[model samples]
Target: MTDEHPQVAALLARSHRLGADPRNTNYAGGNTSAKAAVPDPVTGDDVELMWVKGSGGDLGTLTTGGLAALRVDRLRALRARYPGVEREDEMVEAFDHCLHGRGWLPGGEGTAPSIDTAMHGLLDAAHVDHLHPDSGIALACAADGERLTAECFGDTVAWVPWRRPGFQLGLDIAAVKDANPRAIGCVLGGHGITAWGDTAEECERNSLHIIRTAEAFLAERGKAEPFGPVRPGYEPLHEDARRERAAALAPVLRGLASTDHPQVGHFTDTEPVLDFLARTEHPRLAALGTSCPDHFLRTKVRPLVLDLPPDTPYGETVARLRELHEAYRADYRAYYERHAGPGSPAMRGADPAVVLVPGVGMFSYGRAKQTARVAGEFYLNAVNVMRGAEAVSSYAPIEEPEKFRIEYWELEEAKLRRMPAPKPLATRVALVTGGGSGIGRAIAHRLAAEGACVVVADRDAESAATVAGELGGPDTAVPVTVDVTSEEQVDAALRESVLAFGGVDLVVNNAGISLSKPLLETTAEDWDRQHSIMARGSFLTSRAAARVLTAQGMGGDIVYIASKNGVVAGPDNIAYGAAKADQSHQVRLLAAELGAHGIRVNGINPDGVVRGSGIFAGGWGAQRAAVYGVEEEKLGEFYAGRTLLKREVLPEHVANAVFALTGGDLTHTTGAHLPVDAGVAAAFLR
Candidate 1:
């Protein structure tokens, strides 16, 4: 579709090139457009049309479907109907009326025009680019940005004083461009930059030139350590210690951020973040907040900066964090009260989206891992912008009242409302032991499919990674290798889950080994091995998870995959059966103990699950088959024949049971056993 329209193709190509570099634009931060002459389908006459990146679309991965097409004449005429600045939001609705050919696309649907549509459509040039590059924002954020613009690019790029994005801002930029005949672009005060040209190639070149020139200017004039020298005892901790501290603090920060709603988290200790946190001026700069709309929208008005140095005692650090969290929320609420107007949208969450710790790192939170990660990335961009601005001149963002207006704008609220409903397990984080294969693998996939970030823990590293990849890679699922029987390994796996996705909300204790032997043949070593893997392993995993979940103050689920053999005594299964029994009792015990903290524990009892069963294939099948007087291949059939339903239970059946126990539906029902067997009466609970 893009190929059929050369101008549109050029627009997309240019947008992609600019968007591909973080220095050019933040993710989904900016928009681009092209005006083309197209023959009207009905009139058979050339008519001017404008195609611009639609709302919520990222330029780098944009498609034809993501572009909103509007008639240029209709769009231009909007200038006459434009209400005063106070009612400028009405103009967003006006954009719909300007749709070209009813804005029909590949599937006869129209994309929503972004607020910046006017900025593109109102410009006189054939191609226009509006970007939020760090360098451009640095110049935009400087206290003397207008003067800096003149010094950086002379009269070629004009400077527009700060105006909240709306139809008015578009008119302001267009008027500035028209008044300055030689102006190729303008630095938007405390926002970003905009550039235009008659051709897409020229437009892209101008945008790059503006960004590079700003970068060069800042580099040449910037002072050493713009954030100021690192304070004593504020240097970043050692690598191992930094990560350890990050992991330790991630859950606490995530919990605080989730005071309004559950959120996943991302942690970063990069050089820039560390240097900034170590600086004496960071708290003051951070308090002023990010200048660009895109930056603040993700990072919030400001970050919660930990005042204590990195080497402070863990207990003391945690205590200070809690105190800071309370104060931050109170301050946020006051900020809202101070600026909120009658027509303003209701205040959303008061929790800080970004948390900065000296010597450790920054922790960013959102409803999902990707959102959290991108928020952290945006803050990193903010850091760079502040650095450059502070180096050449004082860093000055828009006033708090202006920021409040944008943050609580009705259009932004409408955008939030337009977002799709979250999945059932959208904010959940699950860790599945033995997640590499069989029952564990199925459970991992199920949880991930329902939108939970998953931690695939298995003894086999390759298998764990394979399953994690199948579940959609790092953002959705991460792989952790662990020997469940080892307490240190179990604790480490939980730590990995915490670091990867903030905290664990669901735990599946499914790692087990099977060995079948007659009473006379069963050895003490076999019994101890089975008990250590299944029974003690469950205890260790549960204990570790309980600490994290308790710290989060959020309820969680723990499901143990016990077996029907635990209740129904069978020949040559003493070791495996006893281990299963231990797991069953542990579920009840933990359920009783942890109920005060809202933690639920449950178990699944399954009959022989032969197909794709790692335990069955590892010699246990032949042993069980011999006891049943059947071939190994017929074991499933033989087991099913003895049951009321005469059905063979599969791994998916157990997976389904896990979901039922944890997937929000059975929230109040725990400390019980779900039977996935073919209705074996002997195994049924009394």
Candidate 2:
């Protein structure tokens, strides 16, 4: 719905425009506000109100309800109650209680106002915009940030030193504004920029204009000299070798960072990441805190740097990388304990959100693909800012204490704490063979909905891509065309999974073919086709996945989709049943062998999941109908009536069983069979 107030609408429009660009804002890092008069709820009098972007909401897609309205007088009056940084929690509580009207939208309520509501209230202008533009942050984070501000904007901009965002920082900004009444904006040292004017257009224009000026200044400096040379003992790997190394190392890094409930969603390598890692001073420079306080919520204070060369053997490097990851976590814990004061919230998991390998590139970690991509974007921007600062002057970010304050700030923590409980399979990766159709396709969709990044592997390339597109595209599901019987294709598919996501946590060995005939009539070709794709294919994929999962040291699940015919002998089903029976036995042996490595092997024996499946599309349904003396369309009814439950077993039913086995509930149980066959007495597992 369109906002009733034109000023509020205009401010929302401007916020979206600025936030739409990642260079301007990264993953809800910036906020905007507009001051206007609205009718008081109880008293029929006009009251001055400030509409600020609600905390934790993305500005790019913000709506009227996403902007919280607060009483300006009450927020300003809170200054007396919160005198210093010690009472920041109390100050934020007071800000929350000062909401205007019913405190939220009619249907949508409970969103907290931006933590900078007080700052926006203190400003005298009608409109305000605060953003973390890369160019501006570059200048603001330099050692001589204040002098650079003066040189760029002259008297039009005020400078505020680095301070954690709270009542005190707002007061400091107010003091700067009072001293320089003619200034249109302020450059926040080691933070960001804030622009204000009488209208939203003026505020946006001033913000962009200041950013442009800083860009021009940095461009001129860039022409003078290069920043530095490649660091000692670190040389860029050849292009092809680098990519191969990245694919090999991705699973190792992902496994090291993963917990029992892991969230290493994906790994990305780009030219910027490579260039940043190739610098001589990257080890020292990257250890400094983020360019702005807002980034602390996305990427931690710094990234973990690995000294191993790109040419290191994957087998030898896995154990060493795991050791480094452990050390990194230990250091993170020490850093937190040193800075954490009394009454502070308990520290969170110390796993690094970003990892840097000198000869390769950098990797960003998150629970999902979008978040990983967002963290990568922030690091890229940081690279640019650091380069610019080094060229002009020297990199000087916020102090460690300040970084800790922002990192554990209640406002920042609230963003994570307020989110709904994650799905059972959230942050886990699943590879489903034959996912283009049949039972495999249903399993892929089901796992993705429960929050796993799915790899849709099928022999039909177009079909696999189509299924992936339907399940939310590449960000959530990736398509891989693989004839699983071919060892090379199977190996490549596993590598692609590691490259697309970080590693594989679950493997669904659901790729199989149906070839049915009496023993006397069964042909050699039919026997080979069924056994090669079902038995041999499962072996290759399972072995590859087991190796990666063992190297990771994190437990994983392998689920095979067997058939009820394997348990109960069916007429004219020799080749299909024998191959499935072989797969079922393999599961038992695999579970016994790989259980030491924390890999669980299980199977699902499903009957008559013919609807919307490749079994039906490939004419297996018609063949089965002929055997039962029923028409093709009546086959579903025939199967449903024969079962004890009188319910047709569906692909979804099979998927649900897969979810139960791999979704952590069966952590201790393996070499087991889950039946989804509508209670077939003959097919029941003993």
**In order, how many clashes per candidate?**
0, 1
Q: Tell me the tens digit of each residue's lDDT in model 1 across 321-411.
A: 9999999999999999999888878888899999999998989999899999999999999999999999999999999998888888889
Residue 370 accuracy (lDDT) in model 2: 75
Q: Candidate 2, after superposition: displacement of residue 555 in Å? A: 0.6
Record all residue pairs in model 2 with backbone atoms less than 3 Å apart, i.e. clashing: 231-280
Instruction: Give the residue spans of candidate 1 off by over 4 A.
Output: 1-3, 102-110
Clashing residue pairs, candidate 1? Answer: none
Q: Compare the candidates by lDDT and give the number of the best one.
A: 1
The CA lDDT at 567 in model 2 is 95
TM-score per candidate, chains pooled: 0.98, 0.95
| Poorly placed runs, candidate 2 (over 4 Å) | 1-3, 102-110, 223-227, 231-235, 259-261
Worst 10 residues of 2 by lDDT: 101-110
CA lDDT, every prediction? 0.92, 0.82
